[model samples]
Target: MFDTWSVRELANADHPPSVPLNPMGALPCIARLEDETGSSWWVAATANRWTTTHVLVLWRPDPRNHRQERLVWLRKADVRPWLHKEQATRT
Candidate 1:
């Protein structure tokens, strides 16, 4: 299923989202996702070393241990207009 989320919702998540990384190291971009279950997930998008596209890493804070986190990788295309729109507003 598909769902839309606002940049405000992400910024208000319990745990602040992680910053995306670059070849030179961490960049200032911060992305987040909201799932069907209403759980908020943090995301970090970094450019691939070889490709012009980006790799999005989704993260959720561990329920059992807040200090720990879980993550999964996704293509930037999955987030579509939301991610693209958010990035545009940032600049």
Candidate 2:
């Protein structure tokens, strides 16, 4: 879960695809991903999932420091719009 990665010795990842709001454009990415135990996932220091609502991707930059952060949270309705925007933006 987020806690695992958040507290791990090494937690970090590149900027996840920006949310659909920013005009910078969109990148292909997964959402609300879960692990085998049917619980939130914490792999490679990347945490995906927020609460029980399945709406967030919180990335950190090495557990050495929690100051570095990048967050992406989207609603159920944002899925389609985000996907459509990405498809159209793709070359």
Candidate 3:
């Protein structure tokens, strides 16, 4: 069966990113996702829309290994648009 997660049930032990990373390794974080059953916010998911319902995510400081981050595919509905405070100020 297709898995359905309410933004919380989604896995944090993410899969390695399906694409390349920015050489700078900066948090070009474009969106956020909730973690820990929606009790807390995991606010560092970067999004590149890959489809109508899925997003390619760059989850930093991976829960499984801090030294290396991972890339994960998440449902678009499970994530919310995020803007860094600096960006928010400009727009």
lDDT of 1 at 68: 46
- Tens-place lDDT per residue, model 2, 42-71, is 323232443333244444435457787556
Off by over 4 Å in 2: 1-41, 44-53, 74-91
Over the stretch 1-91, how does candidate 3's per-residue lDDT look in tens digits? 1112334344443333453443333334544444565443454566653555556666654444556555566666556667667777954
TM-score of each: 0.28, 0.23, 0.43
Question: Best-fitting candidate, measured by TM-score?
Answer: 3
Q: Per-residue alpha-carbon lDDT of model 1 for 1-91, expressed as tens digits?
A: 2233222243222321444454433232344565545665444433221123433433334334445443333444433333465567854
Clash count of each predicted structure:
0, 1, 1
Candidate 2 accuracy as lDDT = 0.40
Collision pairs in model 2: 11-62
Global lDDT scores for all candidate models: 0.38, 0.40, 0.51
